[model samples]
Target: MTKHERGALSANAPKSGEADLETRLSRLRAALDGRAPRLDAPFPAVTLIFSVSDGAARAVTAQGSGATVDAAWEVAVTDLHRKMGRRKLRGRFLRLDWVEKAETWTWALLRKRLREVKRNYSRRGIALEKGFTHLFLEQELNGNAMLYGGNQISHCVVNEKNFLIYAQQKYGSGITVDFADDREVHVFDTAGLFCGEDGVLHELYGAGRNAGRRKIDPLDVDTLRGIIGDASDFLAHQVGADGRFIYGYHPCFDRQIPAYNALRHASTTYSMLEAWELTREPGLLAAIERALEYLCRQFIRTAGDDMAFVVDTGDEIKLGANATAILAMSKYASLMGTDRYAGIMENLACGILHMQAEDGSFTHVLTWPDLAVKERFRIVYYEGEAAFALMRLYSLSKDERWIAAVEKAFGHFIEKDYWKHHDHWLSYCTNELTLYRPEMRYFRFGIRNFEGFLDFVLQRITTFPTLLELMMAGRKMLDRLKAMPEGAELLAGVDEAKFEQALHFRASYLLNGHFWPEYAMFCRNPDRILGSFFIRHHAFRVRIDDVEHYLSGLVAYADYIEAVAGSSDGAVRA
Candidate 1:
């Protein structure tokens, strides 16, 4: 199978032509031969990577750098030739991180950065896959994503904000963790990779594209559907005969994440159904039912008097947990055309309503069984999640109390300006609510959530799937307003152009962190980990929630494409 890659631009990105690469290589070859042609620029270094399948059976990659082309060439080529004695070359690869005369920093600072780089490699993201967002080393295949020896360094490519060089040299581990099990990683600089094939050196990686592949456009309907199907398959595969998901993985060493979240389990099941609307795979359906059965049996509290709440493992009820449980049940009811979980949903919804106050904000957590208040707040996300869940229940039951409670809660949201958080669930609720109410106040509130938020989403490097979900919900709101006669007057303040661009960019940007087969094959269990979404900055952490948001967003975006991009049937399935 051909490798799939994404196009990314970096500082001083390498040129975009094979002929140009050959000329650059020729210049280096001549400089090494003492032919020393007119060198008007700092020549790029060449690196050779090889795979070791000998007795002890390991991978060996030799990297080198020096003051000039000849000097660096001698170090890299000499090492490459030396290693070729007994071990065969896996693939002759080149991606030189350090460039000569490409520095202006003091020697003291350079030594410090390299020392820190060594210090970072042995830290938690590699060892434990988490470091509280400060010192995590994001293992990726990009060359310019490191701070080694302080040559050709770019601040934007730094890892978690722990790098001390620029206020905090935030660059993480430079190791490319996704190279083939048989191939070695090429990281810590922007670009340059050519593989020897059929007696001719061919470009395997360049600044314009990632390792030997082209970009996968997430906006295209066909590509989006294919990705959605793959993601659905991945999620389905995670479900076991007992109905529990595989949870997640660290991926650096392929260790499973140690904990589980009931809320995430419910949300994941909900998203699988959402994708099922488009891809009605029987195996996927079976997995969804198993997961739903797991949710009801493992998480739902049956003892609450006509008001059941989802109790997590610790015997605690979270506003978000019950909300997602309600969502999953509600989706299941609508999908199979049965009311199997209607009573359970009503109980869960009532349980959620009990957690709300007269002034409209949820008590974030409560003790299970007795249903006593544990805390007033745990996280801001629970608020939107609570509102969205009520709206979902209202769709199935048409309960006036549900909408009324939501409106009462929105009073708090509007009064306190809760839209500032730009939560995806709030956007979801606003869209669902306006379908019934369609009031100007709700429309105005919904639009503000995304007003200044698009810029942040567009610029964020992490594959934050919720951001796209927020944008998709906001787009539905925008489309609704445009259809209204009064929308033109309100459109003046909103930059529709910028909003669309950000939405499109974010939808595509998310693909960067996906575990396509090309990269996922490097993991310990390729079949188990393939097609899930990962947070690259977090050492490629793949958990249930990550895939949940990813599947939900992609399914929603694909539905959006179907509706506006010319489908005779514009309705999104249950």
Candidate 2:
């Protein structure tokens, strides 16, 4: 059974404000049933928050640490009562969080955390620069925390800085403790038992949607469209007046990434086009065109050989940039039925062809204008993107050279067994290739790309957006193969049902990375961050390319759902 099919979404998964109060409280009660601190031992800190749906008190939170569970519970309740200023409470969300484990801070652990914090927070300018809330503890739930609000936070990943200002209200402020200096200072490992929309005094998960702890419903087409709409809206909002996306934001500190990539610009535009084709949302087309115009007007440069390369900001050119440039415009032409960019797309294709060598390998990087090979190779994505760009051109212009170029690249790919990388672009191009020449070789290559890979896709935690893109493209090819008598022979070794299961599960799993309001609200700029996709492990970064891959993948999955599972004709449902 699917995770959702087996009641995972109700109690086991986190979805903000959706589950019944009884169900949410049951999860909390189940956790607090037997576990308690040892007698005379340092008890876990108990925190209770009451969010009033009515009455004067909107929400109240109180945290207490003591030598016993009851003591800690009483201290917390006392503080909560003081804040509520009344005994009777009604119509509120509840959340309870406590330290599930506490360990003395070690040098190794501190170093690891410092590295993580530096990786994400170090890039900021004035945002995190002046906070003295360091050299302290943070709270990270073991994937069990649900509602992120009601003055609570729990993530399958980790949330830091809870203890940064634990004892102080401001930076540079010192806490004059009346204790011995030789005492052991311990860091905590915390857990959250968030209540559902239940009643008073019970811990609860807040009513925050996508609050990092809520369960995600199994995706039908409508669900996919909702997330896709959210993400696309985020992209639309990200565009600046200069026709460029403001790159992306780290969001943790509301820091703009500062660095920009032309390649990602074109690729992001391509993703917006994918959404435009699928959604045709009113404001989306303008955003897509403005982004495209930025790419063409600012980045594209024609070489002395009459080939066009998307020059990187530093007077350098990358093969991937040119490919995605073609992809963006080619997709635009295909969707809008316009050839305004045909000449430009042709030159871009020629530039990719120019970079190709006799063995079908392309130089991945070069200096613009001079067209000098700067680097022979960078990433396999470049090769796959090149091939895909060619196929896109072939579909539009019916040029045989584009076909032959992809064929040659495929020859090189097969010779080297490129499928081992499990790159999504390769799968995408391979799917596009087989459409024209239903060659078994291309079909086999697509299979090999995902062969023995679903287990990884299922078990992995990080929401690698490309996996669904790979699977969706490959599944279409697989479906085509299933229809062919000769193709049916190839299926003997594959588990069709397992493949189907993985596709459904992976599509659902990626939702965890989406910027639901519950989780997004914790960031500095919730409005901007909301409706985007994030890599939780990467300090909850919201990058344009990340959103692009996510948006493109969801758009594809939504399309597939419409084909097989029927359709839901609506915008985003509540």
Candidate 3:
């Protein structure tokens, strides 16, 4: 029988809320007396409701009722998916069913049922326990916890006994699961005012309709709040005076980076930015200042060169991913209208410029004991990124030398030698290149093709039948940026289509491909990953179980953190 059926029956014939183990057992016997004939008749499907309202509650089905909770669950959950349509999540169960058979209605059986549900969701890349505040510690339950305010968990998946104890310790009462109806289950606390599924907390404290318009999922937001709160707690608990953050616990094994300082700065800065945009919150400016102070101190003793790489220990640089971080610092500097970072910016800019070869191409790494030219294969991808950075700096400083340097470097991208290397899929590079040098007509040609690619992605999203089609659309977009025009003002009097195409292409590729993934992961593990990662690298694959698909998210988050904290963009501050 399905858990829903059990819950329905249980609700009709329930145990005591406050009765001790023995009394509850006695009450169970008494309640079953009238229902004995049904119990002896057949093992009817029972519906279960795991409600969280007032002090650990439960509603079991009538002893021998013939309710099919499984069928009820399938119908209800399927309906939710159909109703939700495009926003439907992969593994989220709109309804639940019970699996374990309790020889008798006991709390232990309920606990076992919860674990089974948790496992089912976990396989779909959902971490049910991670976002649950009660599972973590008692600290989160008191006085306005952020997770409680805007947190969510898909469902419970773990040891039910442990979960109960955790809840009891935090709330001073055990959890109660109630079957509200054939379609819904509710989790309750002491007052029963707040419910895990439908109590008023979400409507009261969560993001409202504006959030839905912004494409923020209510469930997703709640889950993120938990992850973010947990991360914040972890940092507060582990960070030393030196600002080094430690993660010597489950899931990660032993992988750690010296990034807490940068991460905290980035999250705070991003929050402030969001607050200013979302609310007229005036305190964010002060928060940014405070964040900047911490960020500046972290880098005061470190050399400017090391600041660009993800894990630079005095020498060598990891350029491609680090470029984004550098770009962030540059954007922040321009936004803040402050040149306090001028000294650091100058050093990194010079270092990057020095790395460019006479041929105009650049490598992923420029410094090493053995000057292996093989290690310096013309990495067109990062070369284009660095060029974009140079262009941004020129825009900011209006330095003639900077313009001359970019023009020369851009020239090499179009040469017959370079053009042949990219084939037909080089347009992605030019989309970014156009931003730096829009004056040249030849570059405008490349821009046109890139714009075409953007239209392609849009069409695919609309017409394509599968996720593979979407990915192919992305490939088509990236493969067309082979070469660009020589001058800087290529788009000076161009039609809207050209610019619009470029913008759409970037919006799809960068925002969907990079930004979404990072945000999803940050929502899942906010402490280590941070939300800026989501902004920097924002896209997730069709099903989240594909963890390897997280490279872009990881790199993007790293770059975002660097951008927020560092004085300037890395070796190339653009």
Best by TM-score: 2
Candidate 1 segments whose C-alpha is farther than 4 A from its true place: 1-213, 521-527, 566-574
lDDT of 3 by residue, 1-574 (tens): 2211211223333332333323332332333232212112123333221111111111111111134534433443344344344333232111111212212223344344544542112111101121122222111111112112111332333333444443454346855433222322222111000111211111111121111001212112222233233222322334344433342221111133333333233333432332333223344344444544544454323234533332233334434423433343455577668776555544445545656677776666644333233346545555655665555566667766655665666677666344333322233334444555544443544544333344444443221212222222223333333233433244433444443343333322322221121122212232333222121111111211111122222222223324443564321111
Model 3: residues >4 Å from true position, as ranges? 1-311, 320-326, 368-374, 377-381, 415-436, 440-574
Every model: Cα RMSD to truth: 10.2, 8.6, 16.5
lDDT of each: 0.64, 0.67, 0.32
TM-score per candidate, chains pooled: 0.72, 0.74, 0.41
Pairs that collide in candidate 1 are 143-188, 143-189, 144-189, 144-190, 159-171, 163-168, 163-169, 163-170, 164-169, 165-169
Supply the global lDDT for candidate 3. Answer: 0.32
The TM-score that candidate 2 achieves is 0.74
**Model 1, 174-288: lDDT tens per residue?**
4322212333221222223322211122222223213322244324666677778888898899899989999988764577987888999999999999999898999999999
lDDT of 2 by residue, 348-421 (tens): 99999999999988899998678888899998899999999999999999999898999999999999999999
Q: Which ten residues in a row have the lowest lDDT in candidate 3?
A: 190-199
